[model samples]
Target: MFTWNFQYISKARLSSTLKQLNLSAEQGDILIRIHTAIHLADEAVDLARFVKELVPKAVIFGTSCMAVINKGNYALNRCIISVSTFSEATVCSEVIPIMDEYTGTVLPVDMLCGQIKKEFVRDNTKLILTFFSGQYKDAGHFVDRCNDFFPSVPMTGGIASCAQNNQDDFSDDGFVFNEKGWSDRAILVAALSGDKLENLSSFATGARVIGDESEITDTFRNCILSINGKNAS
Candidate 1:
């Protein structure tokens, strides 16, 4: 069985925030969800620095958000960190980008499923948690690919946002290996299967979908030119 806990930190005391967590690397896995107004590079650097000093051994994974999830409320300019430890189940995780050398001009959606199929070819993958750059190309394509490949692998996580401008935000999430020293903004997949893991639980919430569902009428590359036969923007 696994137990989960959640916490959050703002940009004001990122360093102090990490210290306050009092995480131990020797302990079980810890996932960190960060919300920042800083640039992508800065956010990554701050995260890397904290992860190195605190809980160095835990498997830390999470995405940046405009509004983070903590105690059940959405807040801004803050970072939310969720930690989970496994006592009975063994978890295997992998991260991959939406585009790669082997994919070769394939639709972004197809690329996602292909990566999953390749990495978890043997493990009984149960869930995929991902954070995407709001400006990413082929966002819909990637979602479609996820549905096609592992229809059963429920996906969660938020699209990175730029709070100041309310424009496209770039966010990165990843699965880390303390021993291996690896990290990225790629899709993170977690495969859990062991005699001890008797039950698996997941949660997801998103923006409201108003009015009748409309069809995407026209699109070019990553932008939606039209929806429901009307111009999107």
Candidate 2:
């Protein structure tokens, strides 16, 4: 079995974030999620590169979001770094641009899943932490395909949002990146694998309705495909 440790740090404390992380052991990852009214795409690239320089070997990836929350405080333009160090587990990263840079075409769902299939390991893959482009509304389709191919390993992640300020202006500036490159229309994926790697993601909202369990028979990306043989509204 492998163990992992995480620490969430704000931009104000970023200088020490890496030092505090146990990277000396040399097997870990650094994930950043930035949500800023003034966060520029170029700045994100710089931040990713800067961290990569320091760690040199850790898998680094992240996404630009509309808002970022940490420990109880919320900030629109703050940089929050989520660092994960693992022992007895391994991680790999992939950044796939859904939009064809040459032809300016959007990749279809099946094709996108095909790209993942090339590297996906059914049994060894323990978890999928991805930051998907918010522009693509077909995330549910991707999830469905993943479930079909690798049902046992849980997939978890968030959709990127480029919206900024009170006007909620969503632009094409949203991006996801890995150590190799960054893309405004890509999916940043970090796959973790281990025989006993467990998923510990959870949340609680006192007594609030969590909704009833329902079987989803179909889906079209982010839209509901079907439920109990009935068309989803």
Q: Highest lDDT, which number?
A: 2
Compute the lDDT for candidate 2.
0.67
Candidate 1 residue-wise lDDT at 4: 41
Q: For residues 147-225, what per-residue lDDT tens digits would candidate 1 score against the true structure? A: 7777766665555555544324443332222223333334545555444344455665796889998899899756899
Most accurate candidate by TM-score = 2
lDDT of 2 at 26: 51
TM-score for predicted model 2 compared with the true structure:
0.75
Between which residue pairs do clashes occur in model 1? 25-57, 109-141
User: How many pairs of residues in model 2 come into backbone collision?
Assistant: 4
Per-prediction TM-score to the true structure, in the order listed: 0.60, 0.75
Error of 1 at 8 (Å): 4.4
